[model samples]
Target: MTMLNQMKKSLGLLLLCTVLESHADVLIDVTATMVDPACNIRSENSSSPLAIDFNIINSSELNKSAVVKDFSLYISDCNFSKSLAMVLNPKGGSTLSYNGKNILATSIDGLGIDFTEVTGGTIRALEMNKKQRIYPERVNATLYRMDLQAQLVSAVPIKQLELGEFTSTVTLSVTYN
Candidate 1:
C-alpha cells in the first residue's frame, strides 16, 4: 500500500480502539451509616412499680406529623429470649399529666411523646433528610412516664433484672439512589 494510505489505516485503527475503551461501563460507589441514641433506664425500687420516662426528639430536619409512622423501636436484653415489651399509647389530648406536671403530647405543641416500646415502636419523620431512616428502641419498661396520683397503684416491680448501663439504641437505616 502507499505510505499515505498505510498511515491513514493506522490512524483509523487507533480511533477505533479509543472508541471501544470509552464505551466501557462506568462504576460508582454508594454507602450508608446507622446510629442509635444512647439511652439509660433506672429503677429506684424493685418492689415498687417503676415508671420510666421516654422523650422523643426530632433531631432530623423533617416537619410533618405523618412521618411518625416510619420508625419503630426494638427492646431486648442480654437474654434476648423473652418476648418484646409494650409501650403505653399516649392519650388523645393536647397535654398529658405525669407526676402532677402537664406535658404536651404532640410534636406540634412542643412537648412530644418520644417514648416507644423497645420491641416494636414507631416515630414520625418530620422534615428529616429524605435519604436517611431512624428507628428508636426502648431498653426498659414501656411505661416511662408515671402518674403519681390517687389512682396510682403500687409500682410493678421490674423482674428478670437486666441490670447495668442499659442503652436504648436508635438504629438509622439509609437508602440512597
Candidate 2:
C-alpha cells in the first residue's frame, strides 16, 4: 500500500484502540445498609420468657373488659439515642372481637387475651403487629420500664366461653432507627 494510506490506517487503528482502552466494559458499585445499633430487651431483667398466670378465671368473669393481670417489661443495654418501636405479635392466631378489636386467642374456644399499654395514666389497647413508639418510663442508658395489662376477652357471650384451663402466648419484637 502507499505510505500515506498505510500511515492513515495505523493512526485510525491506534485511535480506536485508545478509545476502546479508555471505555469500561463492566462497572462496579459498592452498596451497604448503614443501620443503627440495636437495643436489648428483657422481661424484668430476666432472660427467661415472661409468663402470666390467670389463676381460676371464672367463666362468668370473661368479658370484653375483664382484666386478668398487669405486668411490666424492661429494655436495656441501648447505646443509641434513636427512637425505638415495638410490635406485639401473637404466637398462634389472633381473634377479632365483635367490636373490631384484635385479641390474642387462647387454647380455649371463644376466649382470648387482650393487651393494653398504660401511658401517662391513660390506657390504650395494643393491636397485633402494629408498631408503637416506645415511650420509655425513663430514657437512659439504664433500664427502661414498660407497663402492659392483659384482659380476658371472649368472642362469644360469657356463658358460651369454654369453662376449663386456658393458655395463650404473645411475642414482642423491638426495633430501633
Candidate 3:
C-alpha cells in the first residue's frame, strides 16, 4: 500500500481499538439537613466591627515596610458545651481578588492587605482562614477568641510610593461548625 493509505489504515485501527475498549460509569450523591444548625453564637461581641488602621507613614517607609495590627473576634455563652471552629467569608468586590492563598485583596492603588491567621504571624493571602477551634464547656467558658492580624502592604516598587488613602473593607461572616 502507498504511504498515505498505510498511515490511514493504521489510524483507523487505533481509533477502532480505542472505541472498543471497555469502560464503566461512576456516580456520587450528597445530602444534608435543610434545617440550620442550632449553633447560634451564644456571645454578642460579634457586633463591634473590626478595623485595621495603618496610621500615616512616610511614603518612603511605606514603600519598604509593612504595617500590621492585631484584631480579635469574641463569641460567648453557647447553649451547650461543644468544640467548634470558625470560618471567615470575606466580602467580595475587591479589585485585589485573592487566588485562594492568604493575601488580602484591596482596591486602593499601590496597596494590598495581607491577613495572618491569628496574632504573631506573617500576613497571608486571602483564603478561608479559620480561627483556632474552641471548646465551650461551661456557660461562660473562655469566650471564642479568634485573634488575627492585618498588615498593610505596598505593592509599589521601592521609592515609587503613591500618597493617598489606603483602606479596604470586608463584610465577613463567620460560621461556626
Clash counts per candidate, in order, are 23, 0, 7
Question: For model 3, how does the per-residue alpha-carbon lDDT over 1-177 read when each residue is reduced to its tens digit?
Answer: 699999999999999999899688989898877743444442234554555677776766654565677666555544334456545454664534333344455555656676655423433333444453443323245445545667666565645655676666665444445
Q: Model 2 over residues 1-177: C-alpha lDDT tens digits?
A: 699999999999999999988955888899999865676778764847888888876666554346568888787766446687778888865655645867788887787777888845677778777887766677555878778888777778777766788777788877873
Q: Model 3 Cα displacement at 168 (Å)?
A: 1.3
Top candidate by lDDT: 2
Model 1 lDDT, full chain set: 0.32
TM-score of model 3 relative to the true fold? 0.53
Which one wins by TM-score: 1 or 2? 2
Candidate 1: tens digits of C-alpha lDDT, residues 1-93: 699899999999999999888856778898888634332323324322343323342333123222232222232222222222222323353
Inter-residue clash pairs, candidate 2: none
Global lDDT scores for all candidate models: 0.32, 0.75, 0.55
